[model samples]
Target: MNDFDALQAVIRRLAAERQAEQRACEAFLNALYHALRTASGPGLPLNNVTFDFTPDPAERLRPPPPGGWHAAWLRLGLCEVLVRVRRDEGAFVGEYGEGGTFHLTGVTEDDLILLARRLLRDVAAAYGGGGLVGRSGMPLN
Candidate 1:
């Protein structure tokens, strides 16, 4: 094959690999979003919860690292949570409000769901109570 043909082949292969990685990331995020939403109970202060794809500087698309392209942001209330899924190493790393961080090795979806639940519960307890005041200096509940 000529040089041009060789380059075209390489580009096609890279595109396919990137697409696969994107699909995997989407699947993981979907499962996680469902877990979080289910865990949020009635009267919970958590609102505007959103998840989006975020790429880490240390990550690459092809030959995915131990912690691959599965990085996402989970935003709720006044907090932004980082969720990094490391499928190759069977682990996950999370960083969030107030310097709180957790690294779970040999992790499972259940573990992640539990962590998210706990974090939201804590935030509600701390900020959603009536002890605090809103911008107008009125009681907040």
Candidate 2:
């Protein structure tokens, strides 16, 4: 094969790999969403959560590089948290934090899910003992 042809082949292979990884990440995000909704454990399941794959408003001021930061906000009642995932050196790296203070790096979907559950439990412990209020200010059962 000519040099150009070899380069093209390499590019195609890399593209395919990137596409596969993207699909996996998408699947992971969807699974995480469902898991949070149906998650059963120490705290209440986050059935009323909202998720979006957009940059935080502050971060939007500066555009992210290719395959840079991908973030999802999990808004539960009056509580809000951020879940961010990105490709770093060909591996998946993730962070989840309450109120945008990301402090954990999760390498797998399961790890991220576990962190999310812990956040939910912490919120419940903090505000739900007396009564948890929904976004609309209605009491949560």
Which is the leading candidate under TM-score? 1
Whole-model lDDT values for every prediction: 0.59, 0.58
Cα error of candidate 2 at position 30, Å: 2.3
The parts of candidate 2 lying over 4 Å away from their true place are 1-22, 41-45, 56-67, 89-91, 98-113, 122-141
State the number of backbone clashes in model 2.
0
Per-candidate total of colliding backbone pairs: 0, 0
lDDT of 1 by residue, 20-52 (tens): 655655676666666677666545534477888
Q: Write the per-residue lDDT of candidate 2 for residues 6-108, one digit (tens) a residue.
A: 9667666677555665555555555566667756643666668777666644455233434555567767767766666656666555655532222334446
Model 1 reaches what TM-score against the true structure?
Answer: 0.50
Q: Global lDDT for candidate 2?
A: 0.58
The Cα error of candidate 1 at residue 81, in Å, is: 1.6
Q: TM per model?
A: 0.50, 0.49
